[model samples]
Structure formats: C-alpha cells, structure tokens
Target: MKRIICILSMLLCMAAETVMAARAPVSEATEECLGCHSSIHPGIVEEWQNSRHARITPREALGVTGLARKVSARTVPDYLLPTAVGCAECHTLNAKVHADTFEHNGVSIHLAVSPRDCATCHTEEAVRYSGNLMAHARKNLAANPLYQDLQQQILGRPVRREGKLTFEPPAAETRQSGCFYCHGTRLEVVGMETRDTVLGEMEFPRLSGWPNQGVGRVNTDGSLGSCAACHTRHAFSIEMARKPHTCRECHVGPDVPAYKVYASSKHGNIYAAMNRQWDFSAVPWTVGKDFTAPTCATCHISLVVNTDGQVLARRTHEMSGRLAWRIFGLIYAHPHPMNPDTTRIRNKSGQPLPTDFDGTYAAEYLIDAGEQVRRTETMQAICLGCHSASWVRGHWKRFERTIRETRSDIRAATGIMADIWARGFAKGPDSDDSPFNEAIERTWCDAWLFYANTVRFSAAMAGGGDYSVFADGRYQLSRRIQELNDWLELRNQLFPPTPPIALRGLPEKPYRVQ
Candidate 1:
C-alpha cells in the first residue's frame, strides 16, 4: 500500500511538471497563461490542444489549400507567421479597445473577446453579421415596448387580486436564464470585487449577464454579437457549425418551430438516416457527395460545390441572404428587411416595427423589389438541386397563397377584437390596457404568433401535412377566430351596451318620433 501511494505521488508530480511546461511562454514579452490555465481550466486547454489553431502554425496554414488559406491570410502583423494561434496571439491584438483589459500577473489581458476583436481576422463575416438582425437582438428585445408587453405577459406570473388580474414582472434570474438565454443579455461591469487567492488578495471586475453565447449578447467591449454562439469555442469546428442541432438551440420552440418542422420532414429523415457517411470537414462542400440531404446550414449558410468541384453557391454569415420573404408571420407575412437596424426602419404606414417580433423576422418592413427577386432566385437555386423548376415554383406559389389566406383570417380576428374594444366590452387596444391580461387578447396573439407561424413554416419547408392540417396550423387558426367571435358575442351579451349621452338627452323626443 505504501509503495502504491509513493508511485501515485510521483505520477502527480510529473503531471504537474508537464502542465507547467505547456504553460511556459514562447517569448519574454508574452504571459505564461497556459501554465496557470492548464491547471485551472484543464478542459479548455485540452480542447485548445485538439483544435486546428494549435496544430496549424501560421506558416503551415499559409501553404494550405482551400478555406484555410482565406482564414490564415487575414492574420494581421506578419510577426505571428511562425507561431501557433495561442491565447496571446488573439488577446494581445486590439488590447486598447477591450473594456475588461487589466494587468494580471505582469501581463495585460482581457476577460472576454468581443466581435470587434474577431473582426481583426474575420473582416467580411463581421461586416455582414453587423447588418444581421441577430446583432441587434438584445437592444430590440430590451427596448421595444410591444415586446416588453409580451415578455411581461409570457414570463410574468399571473394572479387575481381584488377582482382584478395582475401580472408581476419576471425575476432577473428568470429573464437571464430564459428569454435572454437566446435573445441575449446586456453584460455590465458591476464594479470590482476582491478575492483571496493562493498568492494574495486580488481584485477583479464583477460582471453580470456573462458566460453567455446568445447571438446578440452585448459584450463589455461594446460589440453587438457573439461569434461563439454558432462557431462555439476552442475547437470552433466547421463540422459542428454545419450541423442542424447548433441552430436547434434557440429555433426549436413553439414560437419559431423551425427545428421541429425540419426534424419531422422528409429531408430531415434523409439526414437522420445518411448524414453519418457525409464528409462534413470538406472545404468546398459538394452537395451530392458531401450530403444527400440538407441540414439547416446546407440550405442557409454553407457554400455548395458540384461533384466536379464547380462552385454552385457561396457561403454566407447572414442566414437571411437567400431568403426573400419573412414568413415567420408576426402581424402578417412580408418581405425580408434590408438591414438589421429595425428601429430606424419604418413601415409603409410609418410605424417602427418591433425588432425580432418573435425570433428575427418582422412583417412591417421589407426589402426592395430587385433585392427580393435576387434573394428569391438564390433560394430557388437550392431547391433546384433536388427538385424540378415546376415543383419549386408551385411550392412558392402555394406558400404565398397561404400567407394571403392567413392574413385574411388574422384580419377577421383583429376586426372582431376591435369591435369588442369599440363597444367597451374590455379595455381599448390602444389604451393603457395590457394586451395579454384578458383571454380575448391571448386568443388574438395565438391566431397570429402561434398558428400563423406554424402554417407558414410548414408551407415554406414543404412539410405541410402535419403542421398545416392538425398540429397548431389551419385548425388552430380557425378555432381561435371562432373563439374570438364567440367571446365578443358573450361579452356583449353579459355587459349590455349603454345608451349614448346624445341619445339619452333626446330619449323622450326619439320615442315620440319612432
């Protein structure tokens, strides 16, 4: 037993020495970050070691073929050409811009790397993403009154107090962990806190709404988005980003239901059955060879190449680049927006459309006709990969027709609700009344937000049987409209209309004239 114990101690000592060696600085000016971090954050160190960043030195990457060349060519300051992309290689650049930068153990380091930091290397992606709705997700969600009203309704706890229904605002923990988990949370430097470390007392900036990878996360450095939301960290594998599950993180819920529709579709079945055999790591992904079925990335983001190595389409960071229509069905189906700044953009009626009405689509604003045609053609090209031109055109035609019909249904429901408000059965729609407090308002919201979105998503993806027919589709839409009309009728009966003041003053004369 004593001999075994002695052997274990020696092994531990060797392991510690190995970690220390790995942490040793490459140059005198650089910090020995790996040494401490390897001991503290072993998992991070292991992932980094396994990453292409560790394996491919800048010099080696320069000689590589395909996408690697594009990535390596963007590395600034030619001195980094011979070294591996270590912690310092990334953290050291643009140190002045980072708000969290501080002196730590004889070296200056930033706690978080912002999109601006990533822009130094990924110039094109950064620019394109800045114009994406996701970049403004946090601001839009937090700032918009209509969205806040909905948030209060959905997340807030409901209770009846003194014959009135009251909604309590959701707690900070709930907001941070729930909706903000996807929409994004504003990271703030709360102050400084002192910690008792092994060496001595050390001060560090206390932060809130951190350790998040939401697409629109407001970084401490004033950057608007988090690249790690999709690319992930350390490894940042192209394979992982190309998978459908990465998008499923936030797009799976009832409000969006994109993942659910895709997962149960014919395309999804093909992917499930055959994706294991596909070459996900290929640079210019061949459509037929690399994948028999399309993942979310294939149709939305990836560059497609033919079996003969001919480029069919280019990769895009903007997921909506090929999308012409915003079919998520908020108020109504409309054209996709030209830019992410939804607040500044106004509708034809001159109203500021709420940002990310549900999840990154607004029915109010639309792109111009030329751009819309270009995007529609781009999307149709993907359909042409496996389907005929007629099938594609027919599918889109059906989708547009469905949108028109759904809009009519919604308009009918809206008219019924407006009548209820006009008759004073409940609070006015534009009054200080909460739109979510009563059953009637919720029914109206469901008609548009839930049922309409499902039908449109089903039609757009060509997976209509279940979604459009039975599950939260046309059935739900029709039912909600009926419910709205019934509720109005019942409310009108329960609270009979009062005579107008003008009619009341002339009652005796009116009766005589009649």
Candidate 2:
C-alpha cells in the first residue's frame, strides 16, 4: 500500500510537469520590439520606453494611463500613469518572460505577453481588459467591411464586366507601407535580407517576430491573431481601448471618420457626458454594471442585459455572436479566406480545427448589427441611450448608403483607371511606396475607405443638426474618386500608342461572388 501510494504521487508529479511544459509561459517579445521601434517612431515609443511596460512587462503600466485612472481599484503598488500609449506595449518582438525564450520565424524568441501578462503593471487595466471588445477585437472584427474593402481594393481591380460585378484579387502587396500599416501587420519570419525600405524602412529583426495593427492577423504558424492592437498591451485597460481616442488612430483622417463623426453626434455627446460615469475597470461588462457605457466594443463585442433584468459583467472573444448579415464589400471578409464556410482555428496539437469558436470569438462577431439587441436595434443601439433610435438609425442609414455608394464609385474609378492602363496610356506599375503612389493610396482611402466613411458617420452621429452643420455629405469621398478619374484622363492623354482594346471593365477583373 505504501509503495502504491508513492507510485501514484510520482505519476501525479509527472502529469503536472507535462501540463506545465505544454503551455507557453509569458515570453519577452515586447521588450525586444521596443529596443528597435523606439529608435523609429520615437515620439510614440518614448513614453512607453519609460513606461513600466518598457522596463518590465505591459501589465506594469495598465492602470497608470488613460481612462484606467478611473478604475478606482489601485493597490499599494500604484504610480503616476500616462494617458497615452504606443506600439511597443502590444506589438513587441521578444524578451525574457515566462521563464523561457520562444522563437520567431527561425529565430529563438519569446511569447507575446498578453492581457494576463499585463496584469503586473496595471492591475485595473487587466481587470477591465478582460471584459472589453478590444480585448478580443481581432476575433470579432475580422469581417468588418471597413477593414475588408481596403485590403481587397489594394489587391484587385474593382470591375463590373458583362453586367457582372466581380472582385478580382491582384497579387497581394504582401508587406508593410501598404494598406496593412493601419489595418494590421502580420509577423512572419525575417529572412536573411540586408535592407529594403519597402519593409517599413527597417528589416524584420533576425531575432523577434512582427505583429501589425490588423484587426485580426493570420499568423505564419497558420493560427489566428493577437488581441493587443486596440486593447494595447500589458495593461490592456478597457478605458484606453474604449475611448474614442483609441479608435481615432485608424478611424480618423480623410477616409475613416469614425472619431470625427462620433464626436459630432449625440452619441459622442453622451460619451463625453458619461466619460466619468463609464466605469473603465468593470469585468464581464454588462451595460448596467459599468455605468451604461458603450464604446465600439459595446456594439460589436459586449453582451448587455435589459434594463429590467439584472445586468452582469460578461465579455467574450467571439465578437460575431450578435451579428447577422455581412457587409464585407469586396472580399468575403477581411483578407479573403479561401473558404467562407470555414474558419481557421488550430488546436493545441497544432492541427487545423473545425469552424469552432472555442478559442475563437468569430461566432459572436458582428455580421450585422442586431443579435445583441437588448438595448436597441441597429447600429444605433450604442447611441440610443442618448439619442432616439429612429433619429439615430435614420441618420446612420443615410450614412450607410454613403458608404455603399462611395464604394461603388471607388469600383467605378478603378474601372476608369483600368481603362487608361489597358489602352496603353500609362507606364509600368509604380512602386507601392512611391510618394505618387502614396498620394493615390490616400485618394483611394478618401473614395471608399476613409473620408467617405467619416463624412457619413460624422453626419449621422451628429444627428444632422448643430454638430453636423459643417459636415459634408458623400462629397468628401466623391471628389477624391473623381480626382482620380481626372488624373487618369491626363495620365492617359500624355501616353503614346495603344494596343487593341479589350475593356476588362476593372483592371485585374472581378471574380465570381456567392
């Protein structure tokens, strides 16, 4: 009996050891990332360098910044916090963490310290992060139209040939300094290359890996994505990711007016009004539990109970749970997964799993606007707390039309651009990073991706009244596409002889859609 008990204890010890080895402990990728990028985007990297995230791990700085200051749950280990955050906290390459060194590409690397890893710095940030959309936004926002169309436009020429509108996928630009910087950049192995300005003016380190802001990056290991972009790192505080300020990074400017439109809308007014009331540190955020706050995550990633029922805090990585229809304009979803009916989920055994949301938040992700309609219906659900649903929806519907119409115009402009090229009125394709190309890229952004969306959203949010007084309609996007058209006209005129005409409608030609 004694011998048998000893044997059982030995077996238990071995099993524990096996379990421990199977899971990755925190890896130090963030530190290595900071080492280089700090030299690049210094203005943004500096604050973080001094941040505890730079010194230790991301969790060190969680509650020390942004809306996290409002969490009201500081332990004795609190310090002054910076309201602003930068790339290193989330997009690092590697460091020594989890008592082990991981690998990137062929390089020995570390694990990406995630929200749990971040708890060390800002305990409150981690608490709030556990329940926010940004926490798992990568899982949720995959099918977002805004992100989807941008990638599609760059990779293909939009055309309506034979009364058939097909999406033709051009060869992928496949690197940074393209549509990827803003959307999200995937990290792959850094080969033994010397220099190439095209790879973000810096080489992929021979050491750590790379991660971009893409809503959901498809990793080289054939897995899904990291959730740090909007959530940031270490101190993945809900306050920081929930603030319109956070969304502004990608949503502002000429193409995506998310911040500007929200600012002018009554929704924005409420956000500003309740910024103080909106508890940034509540876990499993069920609307009433966290001061009735609603940010981007609320509409797409959060679950809210009715006013009459007891609202509890509950969050999910599955963002599509409430969504119904898909408006991913060009491709099936962002980056066009060769299969729509399937999802790429890998298991611990490293095998491709079925279309499941076990570790995936895709199921709950917003295919449309209503599945989580306890508060209200339509996209206006997030805003109806302050604005009337009808008023909010009416304005936003027009906004949606603008988004649709402008995308159509972008398709039209691409067709025209194609005509010029097909007619032999232009030269070889320019480098994707050239200033001229960048300008053209900006124009494309205005046409469908950014400015057009911004104008419509801003107008709708402001409710077409005082706040929207200065907002322009689709004119913001219309002008850019038209400008591209005009530029093409001149570009074609200056060119020499042409080959036979075979108008493909769009440049690369559209494909069959289901």
Q: In angstroms, give how far residue 172 of model 1 lies from its true place.
A: 2.8
How large is the C-alpha RMSD of every model relative to the true structure?
7.5, 16.8
Q: For each candidate, what is the lDDT?
A: 0.73, 0.45
TM-score of each: 0.86, 0.48
- Model 1 — which ten-residue stretch has the worst lDDT? 505-514
Angstrom error at residue 212, model 1 = 1.4
Question: What stretches of model 2 exceed 4 Å from their correct place?
Answer: 1-111, 114-206, 210-223, 283-293, 310-314, 320-389, 392-396, 427-446, 459-473, 484-504, 508-514
Per-residue alpha-carbon lDDT of candidate 2 for residues 1-514, written as tens digits (9 for 90 to 100): 9999999999999998875453322334444555665676666555443342333322343335632233333442222232123343333322443222344433454334444433434355455444433333344333433334335545556688898544465444442435554544444544444455522432333322344645444444333334466666544455676677876776665444556667766567777887786676554454555655467666654444445443322343434333332322221111112223232432232223221111122332222233334322434554554457687767656655654554455566555555654554442122111111234544544444444444445543453443233354455546766787887767656753465445544322211112
Candidate no. 2 TM-score: 0.48
lDDT of 2: 0.45
Best by TM-score: 1
